[model samples]
Target: MRSRRAGRTTGPHLRPRLRRHPRPRRSRGTGTRTRTRTRPHTAVLTAVLLLLAGPAGCSGPGARPPADGSAPDAGSRSPSAATGGEDGAGHWRPKPGTPWQWQLSGRVDTSVDVPVYDIDGFENDAETVDRLHADGRKVICYINAGAWEDFRPDRDDFPRAVRGRGNGWPGERWLDIRRTAVLRPLMARRMDMCRDKGFDAVEPDLMDGYLNRTGFPLTARHQLAYNRMLAELAHERGLAVGLKNDLPQIPELVGSFDFAVNEECAEFGECAALTPFVEQDKAVFHAEYALDPDDYCAESERLRLSSLRKKLSLDAWRRPCP
Candidate 1:
């Protein structure tokens, strides 16, 4: 009985031992020992991760990595971008008390050489414009916008349909500004010429044609449309455009122009008309052909106009209001 019990226990124990030690099983279809087996899915995942990591580790040309490895802001990507000023949406309004010189007759006396020049557009050449610019002076191309001057290179370009009564000046006739379709492209070309000549601004003279006997029944709306077109064309070429005279429309047109070049605003008791410009922080360059320097000095000082007295011919002989 004891022998039988020993046999039973030994047999059971040996069977368990044999099962535990049974097979050092080889991998199926290969003579390799079976160990911890990783899945094909795990290998595929590792390969995909490595491929993704390769591109992340590489740097492209002109690209800069953020200091903290965060995504870059929109502005950070473009370092050479301009911030603001004339390149942006800001208007080109020249400051008050800006020194300027005006010469409208004969060959351009580009001799005074101030920070600003009021030069005859028809008489001045591209070289003259460049030389004035090189001297650090802002050039204003003076063009007769209200009247047709016989001396202009484009004198023949004005159609008889647009030309009207004489403007009291010899060889000068008033223009029918109501026809904007014909005049806009002409004036735009003129502004283009000024811009191409390196002029920084345009001084469109005779803007007060509506006030004068222009031979056409020019309403204020017609004048406004024509004037606004001039402003837009000037702005399109990045050039500053000035409002010359046109006292009646100052309140309506002040914002459209960069500066105001008025003739005899003080004489007509219309100095108050130009206050809109001063209030809007725009420069008003006033010149009087009739008034002496001493006569208008105090009034000009009170009104804050860059007032000067000169001959009607507009020579270099400038006499500032005291």
Candidate 2:
């Protein structure tokens, strides 16, 4: 199985010292749902609105919503938009063979000169985004929408009531996605940070948490709602969002997300689930860690996916599909 990091890195003060070890994997087994015990709707609206207001002096051309009250679809014709965002609204439709770089360990390796860069959202700063943009690259902010890490700067903001069983990850727990009144605002703030940092799109991780024993009675509907809210939030911020490895929901979520990012789908024989994105002319950035590059390159090329053989750590070492 391919290993992957499961948490988001926060600010400098909150960033944990990098530990030298194999990447963390999701734990197996079922556990009781442990909801954070708190008032469901407390301080939600005010906090979200306050965050929506751009941070002082950091506003850009697209900072505010358009006067018509309808946000620009990412697929709209905006120079700053991603591939699928040819429409004025911030919709995303990345095409096949899109070049991309994915890094999730330590500090971001911004030196790579790829057209699309996927970096840690909380650890990266506005300057990093600016630098990538200066180099004519589109940046994708990496956020963890499915699990909660104890090291996040906003860790205190998450009431213990919403945290469920541990996600087999150290210091990380599964969140009850059904609690829209709570998770939505938190996720909104994360999205706002991505916007503030000038990311053109977002790649939210741990999206497949619902398939595990999350300790909540979370059904498919709950996951769908949460995922949809995530995409909507990214769109509202004029940022394109990709659907990370939630394969089972591809049929339902393909239209909602601007693109798709998958890990080891070829190994599991589930790559077919991602055909909708390609059929729609949306990019699917796929990666596999366990397979030999030569073995999968031909298949990946046949599918026209921008695939790569990567280490579980997702370092700068990348072998792209031919």
Candidate 3:
């Protein structure tokens, strides 16, 4: 999420750690489940929801159908809790409307009272994760899953052959995700670190590297394969995984991931693209670095998003929607 290198200009990746100048203050910026509900109640609720649903299902309450007009899979809605159904493997599934604190820079201020915390996986250790657990919070380990950062401790682990063009941010380059033979073991170790450190989940950044100019002839199919592999690796360690900023593939990936971490969808008029996750009763941890709460909170709430107003640095400071 950051580079210790001096004078690196921030790039427009999903979350930029630093910018040459602060963005002008204004509006704009950017899962799956098991069934927990009783059948009869679910039936009545489903029927009522369908009766109320309209073509503009993107901005309102209740279940949102896919563009093909198919209903979401059945699951008990737990809007009041951040926790979701635990699969047999004991992976943590965060539900829609879950509150969270995402801090990727500086010493994480664990003082924030929230149900979940997303912190740099390499920066924080097992002790920090234990503290969060003691305080009744789910800790998410953040790592660069699809990109190679020059500053990371395991920078040398990545072979130069897999490195692609710079991913906007200094000292970071997109990884050739298609080469799973090399990446699988490398990313597996990162996921193992999250599980070993007691993290409940993983927030893998740059998941949409295929969509960017990575100097690799990556396609959507390549992205899907790599992202699914990431999810499998996390789940293998009994840790939940999030799809970070890969909107185009949500319909296909919402089932593989336990939740999602997004940035600035509201600003780019792309929030509607995220409805698939919400429809599945999964958490959508969203942040807006530029938009005020008043600008998007209402729609965010209706769509069951866990919305926050954060600085580009993504420090401990946050303005959570009430």
lDDT for 149 in candidate 3 is 81
Query: Which lDDT tens digits does candidate 1 get at residues 1-322?
Result: 0000111221100000011122354332223221111111334334433533322111112223233533222211111122112423454566655556777654556656346778867567899988876766678887767677665678799998899986543455778999888898889889888888888889876665665566899776888888888889889988888887665566679878888887655543456556777766677887765544555556665655666655444546565543
lDDT of each: 0.60, 0.65, 0.71
Candidate 2 per-residue lDDT, tens place, 1-322, comes to 1123435342111111111121333222332212111111224323432433312111112122234533222211222434444545745456766867777666666665457778888777899889888877788998878778787787888889889987544577788988989989999999999999888998887676566677898776788999999999999998899998665667789878888887766654455566677877888898765565555555666666777666555656565653
lDDT of 3: 0.71
- Residue pairs with colliding backbones in model 3 are 29-264, 29-267, 30-263, 30-264, 30-265
Query: What TM-score, to 2 decimals, does candidate 2 have?
Result: 0.74
- TM-scores for the candidates: 0.70, 0.74, 0.78
User: What are the per-residue Cα lDDT tens digits for candidate 3 across 252-295?
Assistant: 79899999988766654556667777887889998876565667
Which of the predicted structures, 1 or 2, would earn the higher TM-score when compared with the native?
A: 2
The alpha-carbon lDDT assigned to residue 87 of candidate 2 equals 43
* Model 3 worst lDDT window (10 residues): 31-40
Which residue runs of candidate 3 sit more than 4 Å off their true CA positions? 1-14, 17-82
RMSD list, candidates in order? 40.9, 15.3, 11.6
Q: Candidates sorted by TM-score, descending order?
A: 3, 2, 1
